[model samples]
Target: MLELEKVTAAYSGSKVLFGVDITANKGEITCLVGRNGVGKSTTMKAIMGLVSTPSGDIKLDGKSIFTLPTYSRAKAGIGYVPQGREIFPQLTVKENILLGMEANPGVKEIPQEIFETFPILKEFLERRGGDLSGGQQQQLAIARAVVSKPKVLILDEPTEGIQPSVIQEIGRVITRLKKDMAILMVEQYLEFVLEVSDRCYVMEKGRISMSGRTDELDKDRLQQLLSM
Candidate 1:
């Protein structure tokens, strides 16, 4: 499990997350929902150690990792797909995915699992990342992240601004990914979050205002806070 205990993070002394606590269990999907800038992305950053949370402890499977740098944290089994799909625009899809394994040389050859899950990527192995549609680029970004097979996978708004059909395909892929990895997703799409997540956290102003299993949250409460 990936756990953050009373984590607090800041950018140049300006606070974003205030004593945030969250857990993403192995083989489960944990969803975080909030309006833009309520610290959903900040929470993801804290967990990934992209931003320092000096005051709180971050643990992976019960050991502390608060001191680890971002890349080192990836070495210890964490992968992040940032808000924008940060694939190399000039590189072919196959090359972009291959870069994910730079740290582990013995781990070679793009796994068949990744290609099967995102078959379109296989078809476009020779295409440049910038040439694909936004949704297709998003898929490539995810495929690249999984090449090293990290235990914890994070995605920040994977479906933002995509067409409905592509969104559904992405959702299905997320479901399949959970079978082998822990997932923490931050999204604005309410119905999609409810459909696939095992549990949800409602964030307002950097704190979890309410959280529970997807089935336990009331419609009225979710609508009111999300509309704020």
Candidate 2:
């Protein structure tokens, strides 16, 4: 399991998260949902070790990773796809996916199953990442993370700005991924969250204000919280 225990973080001396606690268990998708700018991305960044967690600890499988750097955290089994689908635009599709292998040294070959999961990737192996459409880039970003075979996969707003058809594909991918690893996703699409996630944590002002199994969430109450 991946866990944040009273995790607090800041940027340039400005605090963003205060005692934020969440957990992602293996074989499940744990989603964090809220209105924009409620420290959702910050929590993801802190889990990825991209930002400093000054006051609390992050642990993976009961081991503290608070002191590890981003790359080290990746090596320790955390795969993160940040907002904006940050793939290497100049690199070929194959090269960009292969780059993720560097997190786990000695991994010289891209897994064959990855191509099976996203067939479009195999078709565009030689194409520059920049040439792909927005949805394609998002797929590539997710592929890059999964190719590493991390214990926990963290995604931030994966459905944002994506086409409806591609969003369905992404949901399918997320469901498949949870069978092998824990998923910590930040999502805004309510139906997508309820459809794919096992648990949902609603965040407000850098804290989890409400959380429960997706099936248990009150429909009208959920809509009210989301609109706040």
List the candidates' TM-scores in order: 0.96, 0.97
Give candidate 1's error at residue 119 in angstroms.
1.3
Q: What tens digits encode model 1's per-residue C-alpha lDDT throughout 1-228?
A: 788899999988888999988999888899999988899999988988877686888898888878988878877777788888888999999899988876356677888988888899999999998899999998888888878888888899999878899889989988888988889999999999989899899999989999998888896889888985
lDDT of each: 0.87, 0.92
Per-residue lDDT for 52 in model 1?
65
How much lDDT does candidate 2 score? 0.92
The candidate that achieves the highest TM-score relative to the unseen native structure: 2
Tell me, by lDDT, which candidate is best: 2
Q: How many Å off is the CA of 199 in candidate 2?
A: 0.3
Over the stretch 1-228, how does candidate 2's per-residue lDDT look in tens digits? 998999999998899999998989999999999998999999999998888888999999999999998889999988889999998999999999998887877667999998888999999999999999999999999999988899999999999899999999999998998989999999999999989999999999899999888889887887888985
RMSD of each: 1.3, 1.0
